[model samples]
Target: MQKTGIANLPLHSGKAPYWLFKRMVALSRAIVELMIIELGREELLRRLSDPYWFQCLGCVLGFDWHSSGVTTTVTGALKEALRGVEHEFGLFIAGGKAKKALQAPQEIINYAEYSGFAPQPFIYASRLSAKVDNVAVQDGFNLYHHTIVFTAEGHWCVIQQGMNETLQTARRYHWLSFTLKSFVEEPHEAVCCDVKIPALNFTAKEAADLRKAATILSCENPEKIIKEMKKIRELSLPERHMVSLSDINPENFYKIFLQTYEKQPSNFESLLEIKGVGAKTLRALALTCELLYGTPLSFKDPARFSFAHGGKDRTPYPVDRTLYDRTIEILKKAIEEAKVERSEKLAALRRLVKITQV
Candidate 1:
């Protein structure tokens, strides 16, 4: 089975101090370079997609292990660390927090043009991953961070985060291309969040019937869907669904429905990719399918942990600058020497294997 899980983190504010952030970038660069050199780019991507490994990486980088900032700050440092050196490692990172997240597609396009690879598949992966977490899974968190990490060979991983203001927590979604079989199924490599509330998880395996029904409904005329949606409003829904009838306004989705109707998507994934199709639209369709077609929905919360060294927030103690710098120096020297010394490369690889085993 694929290694997938969720971690819940406390919502945090403020940024990593410049001094610490600079060190994070340097250390991240050294660690990533060594991983790419020894394990290959694809294996590096696999490790990054693992939530447990990712959280530990943040801790090792001197960030709070349980703080939501780890998701944003770690990826931010990575983007900076890999800048201008992407070609050397054959690894590329795109998208980031807030506004930077929106630039992911264009950034992927630029890299694709430079590397001579098709851009659509990468772009679609980025968008669909975001859509699945943000729309198909209604867990009350709104995504504010999205980053896609890929290689020259086109293998990719997505690390995105969402915030639930009411709960004062953040949930992260991780996706790896190699492990993802279907966007409309259990596609996440891992989802890390603290709390697991009742959520409308249309991507759950149990929701397959609902997904099919929703797709068929989307292809129907808007007028017919509007009528079915209206009829469902008066009926009582399962408490597990956690859908609010008030949130599914039929009139509000008329325009979106018209678009889906014309396109007539052949699958749930295609319908989800349609422009203007969002959480509300999907919820409306889900409710319609349940009430009219007798298809059931899955409210499974797809949420499914480590600290290395001292944390940035000074939890156990303030970051050991001396030790941190020494770690960076060691890794940097190992990477530098590995290029010229076969024995040194073997020693470094052995050390990495031991560390991972721990």
Candidate 2:
């Protein structure tokens, strides 16, 4: 699986008003239905996994284009729009903001049972993607929203968001299962953000050596690693390193180190999957590895992209309800006509081509 991108947006509060939300659901359903019909479900999934396309989608659905709420509101609308017709389209969405994000596993299980497809891989992908973002990549943004959209054939896309309250900004992460590879190594296609702060990116390719060394250190007896941690803490390290002595408390991580010592993970990814291994634990290990092996860890922040139609927040203008409704009706009609009339479908495709050329 490949994580495609991360998008940064200003943190905004409050919900989409009821009047707008209802229209959003209708419009989103029509657009998604048309896409699935014309471009196929996989293509829709691919587009959703692209941060740029997703931002445009939120805007087209009449949400604030550059606000944090775009991630949640747009995805929430999609989930609502897809309700009762998942089997027909072969696409299913799981998870959402806050507590709703925690329900992803069970939702995937339910979808899998209905479709007669194995669910464990999708479940693992969901969990590991979240784990990679939240723990392996210490970007100083704690994730608050998580969503996974999957197809009947088992292809999946993960769209998750994290917030840096201190910074008052939100970052959205995108993942697609189109490519299967190592999760902990250079998984992002791009990261879009206005500001790039130093982050502990263990997933960067530069950190391969650090990952290996950390995995090795993890397998050692907890007492030995604890002693090394204490030694590193006492040393006067260079100021350039992001991990400080205060960040790594050996006592706090002693139990986790013991768990890793027993499990003896074969690789960094395996070590990451272990219970209780989180940002602080990984930081402690990374700091120890850097001091011992002279391997450099990456503290590079990964970030990477827009809008159409009037926005709900009235940036360009308030949501034009009449135009929005008319647009929805046209899309629904086109989809219906395309199903029964070849010429109508061809005409729609031609119009799309002309629009794209513009």
Query: For this target, which candidate reaches the highest TM-score against the unseen true structure?
Result: 1
Cα deviation at 95, candidate 2, in Å, is 0.6
What clash count goes with each model?
A: 8, 5
**Ten residues in sequence with the least summed lDDT for candidate 2:** 301-310
**lDDT of candidate 2 over 21-88, digit per residue (tens):** 99989998998888987898999988988777888888888888778888899999999999999878
Question: Could you give me the TM-score of model 2 versus the true structure?
Answer: 0.91
Those runs of model 2 whose alpha carbons end farther than 4 Å from true positions after fitting are: 1-8, 240-242, 305-310, 342-358
Cα RMSD of predicted structure 2: 6.3
- Give candidate 2's whole-model lDDT: 0.84
| TM-score of model 1 vs. true structure | 0.92
